[model samples]
Structures are given as C-alpha cells and as structure tokens.
Target chain A: MAEAPTNPVALAAESTVATRMSAPPSFDVADFPVPTGREEEWRFTPLERLRGLHDGSAAATAGGSVKAEVTTPEGSGVTVETVSRDDARVGKAGTPVDRVAAQAFSAVEKATVITVPAEAVLTEPVRVSVHGEGGVTFGHTVFRIGAFAEVVLVLDHTGDTVRAANVDFVVGDGAKVTVVSVQDWADTAVHCSQHNALVGRDATFKSVVVTFGGDVVRIHPRVTYAGPGGEAELYGLYFTDGGQHQEHRLLVDHSAPNCRSNVAYKGALQGADAHAVWIGDVVIQAAATGTDTYELNRNLVLTDGARVDSVPNLEIETGEIAGAGHASATGRFEDEQLFYLMARGIPEEEARRLVVRGFFAELIQQIGVPDVEERLIAKLTAELERSIA
Target chain B: MATLEIRDLHVSVEAEGGPTEILRGVDLTVKQGETHAIMGPNGSGKSTLAYSLAGHPKYTVTGGTVTLDGEDVLEMSVDERARAGVFLAMQYPVEVPGVSVSNFLRTSATAVRGEAPKLRTWVKEVKEAMARLEMDPAFAERNVNEGFSGGEKKRHEILQLELLKPKIAILDETDSGLDIDALRIVSEGVNRVRANGESGTLLITHYTRILRYINPDHVHVFAGGRIVESGGPELADKLEAEGYEAYTKGGGVS
Candidate 1:
C-alpha cells in the first residue's frame, strides 16, 4: 500500500472532476479557489443561498449582533477566553479545508476558547448559547479538553443571522469528550459551519449534530487522529420542512494506526422543495493499519415533493485494516409499517407520527441528555402535526 | 355476546389487468365464545377474507354486507373496525422497525380501550401474558416483529389476541410456521382468550396439526373463494384423512 502525498501541488495535479478527494487542504483562503458549483463538494449546495459566505464578500461589521452566554461547573478549572486570531493555538486542531472555512479563519475578529483542566471530572455540562439579532456574523470557537478529563459541551444556536463559523475540538490523551451542537435557527437565517476535531492517543470523542430550523444549513464535520488508538463517533439528525435545505458532510481521516470511527445520520423531510443531503467519507492512509470504521446514512421522505441525496464513500489505501464499510439509503415512509400500526387500532395520522418518531429514536437516544432528547421529541411531534393537516 | 355476520361478500383487488376478484360471495357467521376454523389450500382466498374483514385498502368490496353486533362493520375504516371489535392476525406480520412491543401494545390498547391503561395493572398484565407464552421479559422492549423468528411471530400474534381482547379475532394461518412447542404455546393463548367467553375466534389454517391443541367448535372447508362444506369437529377429522381433494376437483368445490 502506498500513501498518496497530501501536499497541495501534488493533490491539485491528481484532482479529477469525479471526486472531492483531490481537493487540497490549506490554511490560507487563497490556496483553494472559489467554487462554481462544478466541484463535487459544491454541486448539491445552492451557491446563492450561501449569502456570500463562500466568496469572501460577507465582511465583518461592528456592533456584534450575536450574543453569547457560557456556564461552567464551579471549581472545575475551566476557563473561557476571547483570543486574538494570531494566537498560538488558533488553528492547532485543524486547518481550513475549503475557501469558506479559510475565509472564516481570516474574518473573525476574535475567537473563543474554552479549556478544561487535566483530570477534572465535571458533574455538570458546560453550556454555550449564541443568539443572533439579524445580521451577518463570522465566528470561531474551540474546546480544549485536558488528559483524562471527562465533560459534555453543548453549543446552542438560535435567532436570525447569515452566519459562517468554525468549531474545533482538541481532545487530550486519554480524555473523554462529548460535544452536542444544535442548530435551531430562525426560518430566515442561513448557516454554514465546519467542525474539526483532533483526537489524541487513546482518547474518545463523540459528537451529536442536530439541525431543525434555518432556511439553508450546511455543516461539515471532519476528524483526524493525533495518535494511535483514538476513536470517534459522529451522529446527526435533521428534519427539513417546506422549502428548507439541510446538508451534512463528514470526513474521518484515519492516519493513525488502530483508530476506529463510526458515523450515522438520519433525516426526515416533508412538503415541496424540502431537500436533505448527507455525505460520509472515510479515508484510511497506507500506514493506518488496524483501522476499523463504518458509516451509515438513512432518510425518510414523509411527503411527495421532498427529496434526499445520501452518499457514503470509503477510500482505503491499506488492506491490513480490521474492517471498513459504508451504507446509504433514501426512501419514503414504509406503507407496510404504517398499515401495521393502523391495524392495531392507531389512527392513520398517529400511526405516521409513531413511525417517524421510531425512525429517529436510535439516534436521539445517543444524545445521552434527557432534557435535550425530550425537547427534540416534542419538536418532532409538532413538525409531524403539520403533515396531518 | 357479539355476532359477526358476512352475507354474499364479493371482494376484488386491483391487478395489472383491471380488478381481479378474490372472494366471490363469501358467507359465514361467527358468534362470541365459539372457535370456528376456516381451512383451505393456498390461493383459496383465505387471507383475503381476513384482510377484507379488517378493511385493508387493497381489498375492495364490490358487493357485500358485514355486521358486528348489528353495526355495519363494512362502513368503518381500518382503525375504526379494530375499535369496533374486529382483529386480524395476519399470516406474515409486518415488521415495525422502531416501535417497541410494549409501546405498540400500550398505544393500541389506549386506542381500542378508549383511554390509557393503568400503568401498574397494564405492566402486570403484560408480564403475565408473556410468562404464559414462555416469552422472555426482555422481548417487550424489542421492535415489533422486526427480526423475529417465525415461531416468535406466531407467539406475538397470539400475545396480541390475549391482550387486545377484541370481540371477534381472525387468526389467519396462525399455525403455518410454528414448531410443536410454539404451536402448543400459541394454542394455549387462543384457548385463554376463548375461555373468557366474550370474544369470538376465527382460526384460519391450512393444516389439521393445530386442531389437536385448539379444537374448533365448527369447521368449514373453503375452496375457490367460497365455503364448500360446513360441519361439526368431525369435518376436520375427515379432512385430515382425506385432503381438500374432494373440494378441488371441479375447481369450485365438487
């Protein structure tokens, strides 16, 4: 097995029109050219809905419209600070992989960094709430978990804003971290964010990304290992309504030996022009022996006019890995499932609700937060009520 | 006691070439507390009768009249029919991937019984019914019929029959895939429901093996979409010795 060089010039030379794998990764926004919807990564996304986030036209303005609130457990040695863009740890976890991400890197005035002290076991989750007041915003947030520290970090986004931001997680050796990022934006908002995680030796990183509201929301989650024995789990759930576009793209780069990764995302869509897309990519470098990974994406179309695109790709340079596989499926509600429920005395409408709820139950349970799970279920029920009417 | 009466029932299903009739003039009567077995070979329209009674959309009633306790059963929707005391245990139960058996049972009970069941008593009753069928308690949390073995599916159908307590229960081919042990267990569940004397049992099957455990009060031989012979339990014994040969000769019951 030969490892393809990851250099920018070499990758550009190997670039082909059929795949996004050749796109070079760079920290500078100019390294990658602006997309024209011809690239595989940008073909499914509507460029106009991005609100100038991709072309570097959306500039930062004064009078910050988005407010932030942070809460941490007492005596946990946790610190939250706004650091300059040139700080030493600004891009330590990940570099900008695309133009928009790189533009976000160069545009944010200040980046927020939340750190947990080594060996600190927090009994409560650290919560970050960001509310927008109708304006264009660019931001960055990083979570640095120390060795052997176990904590849950929640990022809640709301309100209306044309927002593009970068979120990074730097998990220390032997650390356990769970990050839940929720996008419950206003209907008029447009959101695009890139989540990058650098997992350390023997560390565990679990992420749950939930998107429900927003006119156009696109999230890219990427993971790379700092050392061998690292593990990553990514779970996502989204509900797309009439005229909404929601997309999630994920990449797990297994450059370290003995690392494992699992990705599962489920979505439901209804009404005209409702669209959902999920792309899962797992790349195992030649040296990454004993790497095990699997990814799955499933979508349930609840109405006639909705559409979904699910693609799962696995690029393995080494055959010595333990196991690697991927699966993708997009379909409408199973008529037999509905009929089964209705036969048991459940009315037609309620039967549809139960079937949809059950389709998402597995991923929702992975959130591991009771109140969050309950709230999401309530929201799902309300969304389903509209279909009945 | 409730009575289910079907008079000259004509049912058709949409096929590639216009509508194809499946049950042409099926007539029968099932009274509460009685176990009537409808025996027929494959393609004899046995399951169609069960599904039609439950008002499956695929089966259209071109001409028929079905009444349960003097109420028009044919005029109601599928769920309405269930609430109106009609239950059909399909031969191939559908697999519901995410709804747990316990949750499905509770929801169905809530809809049929018109209110939520008391938590304490409902849990106890479910546990008791599972125990009677020799089912593991852990099975209650599993998805309904998803990945269930044939025997397990039959047991689950009977489990519902014992729990829902519908006025009329149509068990379509409940003995098709059951092993001897599962057959005994499922038969016992059916007997318990019949012992209540408030529900009528329409046990549909293709074999007489299950007749050893669940003795039908009356047996009807069905062929070519209609009942050709009806008699006491002795009819089942005769069919066991002699197959549906006497009924299949003329294609419409010789």
Candidate 2:
C-alpha cells in the first residue's frame, strides 16, 4: 500500500474554506435532524444539556491566550500558529454527537494548527498551553506529525475559565507520536474537550488524557488506525473531587488489516455529587484480519453519593480476527488492596492515594515518553493532594 | 527468646458438604533458633496447618491457642499476624499483576517492620536477598508472581520470607515445585534467615530433599488431620526411605 500523499485532495478541498474563516462556525440546531433520543448510542447522552450549548454566545465569548510551548530533553520550541474556528468538514464526520457537533464547529472556528516538519525527529516536546480567563469559551488544536518522524506534544489546559477545547492529531506513516493532555483547570472551570487521532501505516500513536481539574468534563476521544500494522493506544485517567461530573467516551476504529488498538482507562470519583462515566467502543472491520485488540475500563467511586458508569463494547464484523476482548468495572476502592497497603504502615489516606496512583500509573507507563509521563505524574499527584485536602 | 506454640488447636474448612475439621487437637511448639519440619501426604492437612497458623480467612479455627512470643496470633488479622512477626510462604503464591515483586516486598517489609527502610539500604537489602536466593536481580521489577515459572514462584516466596523477617516463618510446601537448583537456593535463604538467631521456622514439605541443606530440630508426621508421630531428624530420613505407607498402615486415628 502506498502512503497517503503529503496533501490529500479530499482534505485540500476543505482547506479552501480557509478564506471564509468566520468568527465561529454557526449552525442552527434545527439544520440537523433531531435525535428522537431513540438511537442506541444516543440513549445515555443527555440531550437537554446540549440545548444550553446552542444559541449561546459561548464560542464567541472565548478569548484568551493559550501559552503554547514545547520543551524536550534538548530545549523548548515556540508556537507556530493558533487557529480557533469551526470547520464545516468536521461536522460531516457522520457521527451522531450532539455535544461534539457544537463543540466541533466552535473548535474548528478557533483552532491552533501546529505543524512539525516532515521526517524531522524533534528530541524535545512541543507544548501548547490553552488558557481561558472568565466566561464560557472554546479552544482547538490540529497537530500534524510528518511521515517517518517522532514528536511529543503536550496540551496543557489551565487558567480560571469555563471552556471547551478540541484537539486533533494526524500521524503520518512510520511516524511515532506521543500526546499528553493535562486538563488541570481551576476548580470552577467547565471543560468539554474532543481528542481525535488518525494513525497511518506502521505508525505508532499514544494518547494520555488526565482529567483532574474541571466541573463538568467530557472528553470525546476517537482513534482510527487507517493503515495496516498501525498501533493506537488511548489511556484516560480522571480523579474527581466533590461536586464534579467527569465523563470519558472513546471510540477506536480498526479500519485496516493487522492494526492493533488498546484502551486502558481508570478513574476515581469521590465526595458528594461526584459522577463519572466511561464508554468505550472498539470496532474491528471485515478487512482487519489478524487484529488483536483489548480494552479495559476500571473506575473507583469512593463515597456514598459518588457514581460511576462503565461500558465496554466490542463490535467485530468479521470472524477472521486473531483476538478481541473488553472488560469494564466500576466500584469503590478494594478493601483488600487498601488493607494490603495500610498493613504496610502507609497511612490510610496515603494508602488510598497510592492505590489510585498505582491504578493510573499502569496507564501512564504506557505513554512511552518520559517527559510526558513525569508531567502526568506531577499533575496527577497535585490533583490527588488537592482532593485529599 | 521467642516462642510460637499451638496448643490443642482445632481448625475447620467449609467444604462442599459441610464444615470438616482439618486440624484436630494438634499441639506443637518451636522456640527461636529452631526449625520444625511437618511432613505429610496429600489431604493430611499439612497446608491447612500452615494456613491456620497464618490466620488465612478461609481456615476457621474453632478451638486453639496460637501464640507468637506469648502474643495471641490467632486473634490477629492475616496481615496483622504478619506484622506481628508471623510469615507464611504460601504453597501456591497468588499472582498479582501490575504489582512488582520489589514493590510488594517493600510494602510487606514496611508493614512488618512498621516503617519504610532507607532507599539505599532497602535497595541493597533487596538485591542482597535476591542474590542470596540465586534470583536475577532484575526479577525485582517484574509483576508479583505473574508469568513466573514454578521454581521462580517458589523462590519469590522465599524472597519475601527473607525480606520480611518474622519470629516464626511457616513455609507451606516450599519445596513442592522447586527444581534441585531452586530448592538449594531456597534452603540457603532459609538458613540465612535462621542465622540471624531471632527467627524460628516451620518448614512443611512432602519430601526430604530440602532437609539435606537445613536439618530441622524436630520432625512431625501428619496423618488424618493429626500429628501421629514426632521424632528427630532421622525420622525425616526414615520417612524419605519408606514413604508415608508405614505411617498410614499404622492406622493412627485423629
């Protein structure tokens, strides 16, 4: 199979609308068919909350500098450009996501395009920091890793603001990409983000999203293995405190043969009104022979009023696959695990934090970038300290 | 110094049919610097005795007094007993994924010793212990017992026993799955623990191969949920020569 051209004509057609770049991608909710709330996929998603998104000046109100910087073992890099706008091409993704649609438009209208040079192996990471100040806002980023290259991208969302962010990544053939997004906003921030990745042939892509700061946080993360032998792994770790609602929905599409995809997500929700939801869908196509895939979602709900809902789905259309399996579980901390740690003289709180950290550490170690892993650890520990506080 | 005594012990397990007494009216005592070997055939309750001594939640002790250094061991939780200087090298150690052996040993050591060891000293101790057991030092980073061979698992048990020094270490069939090389290394580790002079040991085995390196001060024969015979080191040799056929044929009742 030949590699996808540097500039695909189909993708180029959408770029022509760059001239009509508006303030924000505007779409009347009535322009699209109303989901009767009957679709199996849309059943659980709160449709009413989306009404608050539409007809609101939230997207236009988004104005703040996202201090984007990239630091590697070698040195730091500068931000090339930050594009914040809604691209109509993203809305035609043929997916029924009421939340993603408005956020996609709002994100495409305001996107930060960061392009790493072709075949350039940057030893350092490219950091894009998105900062929002007061009102409801949106931020988006498009990261393109050139073919046969390696790069680490860290998206740090901070500041005292309630906003939504979209992050899209395109990994070229034989390229290796590691992306770590730290959603560490102020406690009062409302963060809704989308993370999408397209991995090419023989390419390796890893995404680690940590949601430790936010009021109502939802991450729509999707990964598509578009070429054979590509490997895609997505890991999400979220720790919620009191009165926080965090949801993570991930979709992995194995479109080509022999591609491998794995998802391991863990979250801990504590205190009153703490709620978390994890939805994972792994689709193995008919041509994806010899595809080995596995997904596991484990959540710990520590408090009487806290709730966690986990769903792991494996949809295989072909029997020629090598292996496929998924597992999901949500509950409070294991007394046995806790006791095992406490018996070691680790105090109760320290033991619980250790277990939670260990739970997410398993996924963090899979991120493959030492810098990203350290940042995640620092961010996660900071959140843990605050939660225990 | 220290002493571990089980007086008139009665242990029962909830089997498919009902509760069946596993250890009945068994009395044993071992003082510091002494190693006691309990040899028995299948279903003779040798492992049950070890579990009962370690306070495994599965084994219910109906009547017994298990005292470690004059402290009631049966009254303690499994981990509590361990913290109170009681260790059980499980016959079949459970494989825990995502938890490294070194991490588990550190946690266990901290639990038993009531504080974390100095990082430099702890690393040195773990390396020295693993080295003493003929284990690859790299094994410390591998998941606890996950994907380990039979000999490796048994050695891992010995690894914990060496790290978590106890007043009385109960090794349930430690020699069951070990190869001659692994068996020798495990025996050496056991001897090193005893060399400290502060820890007694209960070495449970079906064969006497391990007895060559570490001879026990006392040998007890278990048959039908009770210790039918008690003798010195030669008894182990006699049983190794004739097998448990003679003991069972003698028809000792519980």
Candidate 3:
C-alpha cells in the first residue's frame, strides 16, 4: 500500500507548510530510490557501515538467524504464532516507509503475530528474547491488543547479526500498552530497524528503547493516532562508546483530534569518534485540533573527540492546539556539579557515577517494571565502572 | 584540638589578560571551638580565601601554606581535604539534579566516616537534624538544591555543616540572603555547632546582622584582597557603627 501523496493545492489552501515526509509508505522494495547519503533522512547515517542492509547486496543467507523465544504467563490466554505473509493483521498496524523496511517486508519468510483479547489485564509482561547467531536477518513482528486490554511487552535483543526489521503495535480503543525494547547487541553487530504504533481511540501506548552496543545502530520509531483522545509517550536511553554510531529518530503524527504525544531521549557519548544523533519530528494535522505535544533531548559528552547532534522539528497545520514545545541540550560533565559532590567527600569516580546515574534515574523509573529497572541499573553500573576506570 | 593555620596565602585566578591576583596575603589560624567572623566589603577576596582553602580548581595558590593540625592541606585533593576534616558551605550551592538530599548526605557521611552509618541510626539522625532547622521531612527526598529557594539553599548548606561535622567549617556569605526568621533559624543551627566545641567556624559575611545571633570571639576587617585590621569582638562593633569606608578610602577597590 502506497501512502497518499501530499496535495500541493490542499497545502496552499490550508496555508500550512507541507510536513508529509518526502518518501511515501509502501510494501514494495522498489518504491524508494537508492540513497546516496545526501538525502535528509540518510545524512547522519553511515550508509557504508550498514554492511549492505541499505543496498541489498548483503546476502540474506549469512548462515545465521535471530532465534526468538516467547514466554507467556500461565493461563494468560495470549496467542503467539508464526504466520505467513498473507496474515490479515500483519500490515494493518503499519507499512514500510523506507527502503530497509520494505526490503525487510519483502525478504521475511514468516511473520510473528501476538494477540490479546479485549478487557484482559495482564499481571505479567510478555517477554520476547531474540538472539542473533552471526548472520544477515530480515524479520517482521506485529502485536494486536484488543479494546480496553492492559498489556506489558518486553523485547530483548542480543547477540551479533546484520539485521533490518519492522515491529508494529495495533492497539485497540481504550487499551493501554507498555513496551520496553532493549538493544544490547554485540559490538560487531550492525542493526537498523523501524517501530510503529497505531494507537486507538482513548488508548495509551508507552515505549522505552534502550541501546547500549552495536557498531552502528539506527532505530526509527513512528507513532500515529487511530482516533481521538489517543496518547503516545516515547522514551529512550543510549550509551555510545569509542568508534560507535547510534542514531534514534522519532515521528509523532497527530492525525486525530484531542490527542497527546511526548518524546524524551537521552544519550551519553564517550571516547574518540563516538557519535550520537537524535531527531524528533512532530506533525499536527489540520484535523488534530486540541492536541498537546512536547519533546526533549539531552546528551552528556564524557570524553574528548565525542560528538552529538540533536534536532527537533514541530509542524502544526491547525491554529487550535492545546500546547507544543521542545528542548535539547548537550553538555560536558559539569565541573561544578562534580566539584560540589567531591567537596562533600565523594571521591571523583563515585561523584561521576552519581551524576551519570542521576541523569538516567528519572527515565528508568518511568519504565514501570522493577525487574527491568534493576537489571538496567546493574548494566549501567558496569558500563560506568569500565568507562571511569 | 584541631587547628587550621594559613600563612602568607596568596591566590590568583585566570582573567582575560593574564593571571589576576585575588588574595594578596591572608593570615589566620582558627582553632577548634573558636568562631572567627571575617567581615569585609564586596570583592575583598573573602570568598576567594574560602575557595582556596577548600582547594577549588579555579584558584591557583601562587604562594601559600595551609595546614590542619600540622598536616599539609595544600597537598590534598578536594575530596581528601573534605575527608581530612575541612568543609566549605558555598554561598551559591550547586544544584545536582536527580540526587536526593538524603542520598547526598548519606554518601558524604559515608566518605567522611570511612564507613556507611547504620541505616536506622542515620535516618533518625537526619530526621532530628531537619526538625531542628524547621525543615520538612519531605525535603530529604528532594533533589540536591535543584529548585530550592534562597533560604532553602542556605538551610541545606547548614544542614550539611551539622551532619558532616568537619573540624574546620567555612561559611561563605551564608547569611547574605535570608529573612529575619530564617536568619535566626540558621544562626541557631550554627550556634548549636559552635556550642558543641567540636569544630572551628570561619564565618564570612558582608553584613554584621548575623553577628548578633552567633557572637564571634574575634573579628578581622578584610580589604584590598587581604586583612588590614585585626581586633577582638570590638572590631565587629566598630565596623557596624562606621562601615568599611574607613578601610577602602585609600585606592583600595571596594
């Protein structure tokens, strides 16, 4: 399905700048012209480091696969199945908007679909652990949650592979969904993926994306409202190390009236040539009256030769909106904050840990899962100890 | 008894042109249980003296000798100086977002005491200390000075002063911005420490108002980036009556 192209006449009549992204959504790999690193969306990404995920030269037969294991609570009544490409619910949530996603859709042999019935409140989170075994992989996943249902999903990615995938959430009206996706891939891995959420009327969807490893990892998360009163919250945390490139791009499309969306992403970069990029784009269509939106991005540069680029773009087509705002800041470790803590008898190393931990503590608590929170904290501690030492 | 002795302390800070000297030569010795008020006009380098003693990286000790109980203080790092019984309550306390007051205090105490205090006793200690300062217990969970008002920042500094219990405590214009009620409340906390006779106090101020609440045994008149006049408590009385015009009249920058 090709996304409807923007009408220049309508744009002129509405007197609003064109905000529809240049590339239209499609499930065919041939729709997107090959990017030469000059395209706005491809500028910050190192196309070469993608190892052919962009150009389709990398053989999909790299002799390894991403094995997935799903654990459902007893009597949870959640059904997880591997279905063919013709599954009716597969593309209902989202379609490919970029070449990598289209390639993933065209290359995958099977798709995984998870479903929950209406009004079911889950006491335990559905855990999906995907392990890559050193290969080229393309995949697709869809989660369909029924109306008024409450669900928590955890997607844990590990191991080494060159992979491109698309994951979508089809939330029903008045349903609430929380998704925590952790990308702790190996250092040799190259990962590029897209995540989409179609929030239903009066529904709430929250996503936490944590990235720590991989030579080059780029994730694009896009959210669109299915009806009025829908809400979407996107939060992310990433740590970039020496010779690593991590980029996170987000889009929140307020296509319905009376919807809300928020975005906050934080990253810490260290070592020579470490680069982290954050791009947040929000569009309030003419019909999205009474919308409320805000976005924030913050980065901490821990060492010399590190770089960060943060950009936030907000476009409104209607004058009747509740509110909109954005803020972005990238700073070195504050000397005064460190000095203040050291003067209070905290050693230099401990002081550094305190400030870095404090920086992430706010977002970690928002995950709402104690087990994941503790594990992430432990992972952060190990990372800090290594960096400081 | 602990003794903090400073002799011929000269400090300079980096300016646009070159190194500009802030403290020409400061000499003082504060012994345990002694409260010495160093009153001066603005830009007299009183805060410089405080920061230099606490080993602020911004200041260079061009020529100086700072010792505590005959041990070289100039040789220690900031945290070492802190653990070695030296504390500076900054005039403008730095904000540490996401670090709770309780966690900060407990961490500082652990570093100073060389071990973590028993959790039960530590909570009790913090509760009692906050009560005495008329502080709400909820403040403990609040971030360190993130959005605290003027009086609240000052009170937090004093809270640390009492909780950390360093041998030599330097208050850098801590009374600069406080209401009368807050002034009395803060002074009472200082007086409590002074009465205990466990730590020496170096009170830096631009006004004589706080002197009424916590009496000083000695007062030094600071001007021209150094002390020009030294006297007993009578010196504070004189400065209150006449002001520092007597000291800054002759080519000395105020």
lDDT tens digits by residue: candidate 3, A296-357: 99999989999998988888889999999999999998999999999999999999999998
Best by lDDT: 3
Number of the predicted model whose TM-score against the real structure is largest: 3
Model 2 clash tally, residue pairs: 18
TM-score of 1: 0.95
Compose the digit string of candidate 3's lDDT tens values, residues B1-254. Answer: 99999999999999998999988889999999999999999888999999999999999999979999999999999999999999999999998887899999999999998999999999999999999999999999999999999999999999999999999999999998899999999999999999889999999999999999989988999888898998898999999999999888764533
Regions of candidate 1 where Cα sits further than 4 Å from its true position: A1-23, A60-64, A386-389, B250-254
Please report, in order, the local distance difference test score of every candidate based on alpha carbons.
Answer: 0.87, 0.73, 0.88
- List the candidates' TM-scores in order: 0.95, 0.77, 0.96
Clashing pairs in 3: none
> How well does candidate 3 reproduce the true complex, by DockQ?
0.86
lDDT of 2 by residue, A1-389 (tens): 12332222111223322211222222332343444445444445454443334334455555544454544344323336644354432322223244444554533455556667667778777777776566666555667777887888887877766565566677788888888887887777667666767788899988888888767677878777657898888888888787777778887777689988888998888899787788887777677788989999988877778878788877776899879999888866666555544433345676666667776767888888887778778877777787765
Give the C-alpha lDDT of model 3: 0.88
- Which lDDT tens digits does candidate 1 get at residues A156-248? 999989888899888888899888889999988888888988888899999999998899999999888888899999999899988999999
